[model samples]
Target: MTTTSYRTAEQIGHTEQGPRPLPALGVQTAASQPSLVDTVLPNGLRVIAVRKESVPMVELRLRIPFAGMDRLHAARAEVLANVLLTGTERRDRAQFDTDLAAVGGDLSSVVDPERLSIGGSALASGMDVLLDVLADALTGAVYRDEEVARESERLVERITMARSQPSVIAREALQKHRYGDHPFTKEMPEAAEIGEVTPEQVRALHKAAVLPRGALLVLVGDIDPDGAVAAVGGALAGWQSDASAVSLPKLPDLTPGDVRLVHRAGAVQSQIRLSAQALPRTDPGYAALQVANLVFGGYFSSRLVENIREDKGYTYGAHSYFEFTKDNATVLVEADTASGVTPAAFWETRYELGRLVLSPPSESEVDNARQYAIGSLLTSTSSQAGLCATLVALGAVGLSYEWLRDQPMRIADVTAEQVAEAAEKHFAPSRFTGIVVGDADVLAPQFRAIGGVVLP
Candidate 1:
C-alpha cells in the first residue's frame, strides 16, 4: 500500500500555478428594467401595486405614519397595534384566531419609531375576506379596556425579559447613545406607563395617525391589477385623509467621541456594539456604503468575520451593517465573545477599522460585495411577500418604485474607490460609540486599556 498526501497543483506535477479568471462583470445594463406603477384613489389614499403572478398567495402591507415623541400617543400606537389584532367588532379573539387558522393566514402589526405597519398573508381565494378583516380592524377597532390591560401586561413581561438578555440590553444602550434626546432614544415605557394608557387615547391616535392620506396599500400575489386596486380603494374610500401635513423631525447631530461601554455583572460573555450616524436611503452614497459595509463586516466572509472569528477565534461571529430610514440612518458593528477574550476582540475590531480606513477595497473585493448585494435583491424580490414589503417601504418614504427596481444596477456600478471612500467617511474610529455588556469587573481593565469604557 502506498501513502500519499494531497498537495497543491505545483507539487502535483503541474508546470506552474495560474491565476483564476475574474467573475463576469457589468452584466446588468441600465436600460432593461420595469417601472413601478403609482395610483391615487378618489379618497386621497395612495396605492402602489406591483403585479407578480408567480405566487398563489398575496401579501398586503398597510402603513400609517403617526409615530411621535409624545409618551402618551406613542404608547397608544403600540397598544392599538396589539389590541386591534386581539379582537374586532365581528369576531372575538378566539374566533379571530380560528378563522385565520382555517384559512392558513397570518396577521401582524408593529409600531416603530417612524410608522405603524399592519400586514398579512392569505391565499388568493381568501383575499376578499382577509382584506375585509384588515379594513375592519384598522377602521373600526373597539380597543376594549380589558384587551388593552391584558396586552399591557404582556408588553411589560416582554420588556422585563428583554432587559435580562445581554443582546437586548446592548442594543437598547446603543440606540440611546446614538440618538440621545431624540424620540428614537426615548426609554421604553414602564409598567406604570402602560397602565396609564386609556382606550380613548388609543382611539384618538388611531383616528389622527392612521388616516388614508398618509397610508399606502401594497398588494402582491395572483390577482388582477385593476380589480385589486379597485377593491382596496373602495374598502378604504371612507376614511378621511389628514389635510394638515406631517413632517419627520430633523436627525440630531452625532457628537463624535471615545468608546462607550455598559457593564453587566454575571454575564459570561461580552456584547460589543460600535456605531456612528449614517446617510439616509436617499443619499447617492447609500449603495456604495452598503457595498463597503459588506466588505468590512456585513457577511460571513467580511473582514471583521475573517479577522475576528476565523483568524483569531476571538468570538462566535462578528458583523456590521447600515440601517437606512427616512429621517436618520445608522451603521453598526456587533459581536459577542467570552468575557476573558473581550479585550482581544475589541482590539482586533479596532485594527480592522484602521486597516480598512488606511487601504481601500480592491476591485475584486468591491465586485464580489456588489454581486452579493445584487443577487440578494434579485432573490428576495422573487417572493410575493418580499416584493410587497419593499414596495410599501419605498412608498412610505416617498420613493418611487422605479428607484427600487433600479437598485441592483446602481449597486453593480459602485466602484472600489467609492466603497473605500464611504468607509473612511462613515466609520471614523474616533467617532465610534462602543457598548460592552458583560462582567465588568472581569473585563474592565482590559476594556479601559483599549480606549474608553462606560459602565451602566
Candidate 2:
C-alpha cells in the first residue's frame, strides 16, 4: 500500500477544461455597475437608493432590526409583523388591497430572526402613493384583538404543518441538538404559548422592535434618493418609541463527539447532517474558509459531489458551508441518500473530509475554486434586486460596498496553503458532530463502526 501524506498538496494539474477567464475587475459593463446613494435620516434610519433606468418599476425594502421579538418578546413581535398588513388606522384591509391593486402594486411583510422587512414594488410613476401606503401600514397598523386571534390561529396551523414534514423535523432537531438551551433552538412558540398571546403583548412588541433607530430602507429602480428619503421620513416621523437596545446572549460552546439521530418511519431517503462550531464573519479566515468549503462540498463539482455523487452514485448531491455571522457561526455538511446506501454515504463523507485534512488541494484545484467563487460574486451583482439585497445584507453585517469591492482581490489572493490550513483547522474529523435521520436498525451498526451514536 502506498503511504499517502495529508500534509503535502496533491499534484493534480488543471483539468482538460482550463480555468474560465476572470471578468476584468474594473470592467465597465453596464450590468455590473450599481448606482447606489446612501444617506441617513434625522431619526437614524439608513437609506440606500439604487437607480435603475431600464425598469419602469420600483422596489423598496424596509429592514427593522427588531429581531429581539423572537427571543425576549416572541409572540408580540410575531403578531405585530402579521397584523401590520391586516389593517391600519387610515385604511381597512379591503381598501388597502384595492388601492395597491389599482396601481399594479403589491405589499408584503415578514418578521425574520433578526429583522422585520416590509417590501413592495410598483410603477415608478406611482412610487409616492405606494410609499405613503406602505408607510401608513407600518407606522399606523391597528393590532385589533380579533385580528390577533385570527392571525394566531393561522400561525398555529402553519407550525403544525411544518412539524409534519420529515426534512423540517430533522433540521429542527439538529438545531436543538447543536444549540441546546440557546434561544436559536426555540423556533415557533408552542400552541399553548400562541394561545396566550394578547393584544397588549403585540402593542408592546411593536413599540420595542419597530422603532426607526434600528431600521434600514433600501430602494431600487427609478427614484430620486433625496425625494424618496423625504417621503419615507414624513410617513414614519410620527412613529416614536422608547425601544431599548438589542442585547444577545453569548453563544454556547459546542462539544465535540456529540452525535444525534432522529428516526422517522416510512422514510424513503435519509437526511444526514454533520456540523462543527466555526468562526464568525469578522474572522480574517472567512475568505479562505469560503474557498476551502467550495473545494470541499459547496459547489456542483466540489469534492463531496465528486466523491458521493459522481464517483460512488450514493446520493443526489452533497454540500458543506460556513454560516458566517457576527455572534454565532457553524460549518455543516448535508445530504440525502437512499436508506440502504446511507452507511456508505456517511463513511464516504467522513473519508473525503479526512482526505482534505491529510492532503491539501493541488494548485489548479485552488485556482479553479477561487475562480468559481469570484465568478459567483460577479453574477450575484448583475441584477438590480440582487445588488440591492447584497448591499442590505452587507450593511446588516456592518460592512460596506468598499468591502465588497475588494472581495475579488481577496478571493484571488487565497493560496493553496491557506485553503489547506483552513481545512485542517475547520474540517477536522475529530471535531465533527454528526446527525442522521433514518431507520436506526439499519444505520446504527454502520454509524457505531465509524463513531459513537446518540439516539433520540
| Cα lDDT computed for each candidate against the true fold | 0.76, 0.75
| Residue-by-residue lDDT tens digits, candidate 2, 1-456 | 999865321224233475343344443222344566787777777887777765787787887775452444655666777788878778988888888887778888876556677888888788877887887876787788889999989888887887877678778778787877565555555555777778887876666667777567888877776676777778767766555335335567567785676788777789988988877655788778889889889898688998999778899778998764446778899989998898789888888888889987878778778878888987886565766677777777666666677777777888899999999998887778868898887777777777656765
Best by lDDT: 1
lDDT of 1 at 390: 81
Using TM-score, give the best candidate's number.
1
What tens-digit string does per-residue lDDT give for candidate 1 at 1-456?
A: 999988864344333453343457567865344433479777666777666778688788887765576766556767878887777678778776777766667788987666678889888777777777777776777788899889988977876776677887887777777776567654465546777888888877777677776567888888777778878876766566656224346667566666666768788898988887877778899999999889889987688998988778888789998765666677889999998898889888878888888877888778878888887777877789888888887776678777877888889878988998998998767767767778888987877676666644
Candidate 2 lDDT (Cα, 0 to 1): 0.75
Runs off by more than 4 Å, candidate 1: 1-26, 30-36, 98-103, 243-248, 454-456
RMSD of each: 4.0, 6.9
For model 2, the superposed segments whose C-alpha errors exceed 4 Å read 1-34, 68-72, 244-247
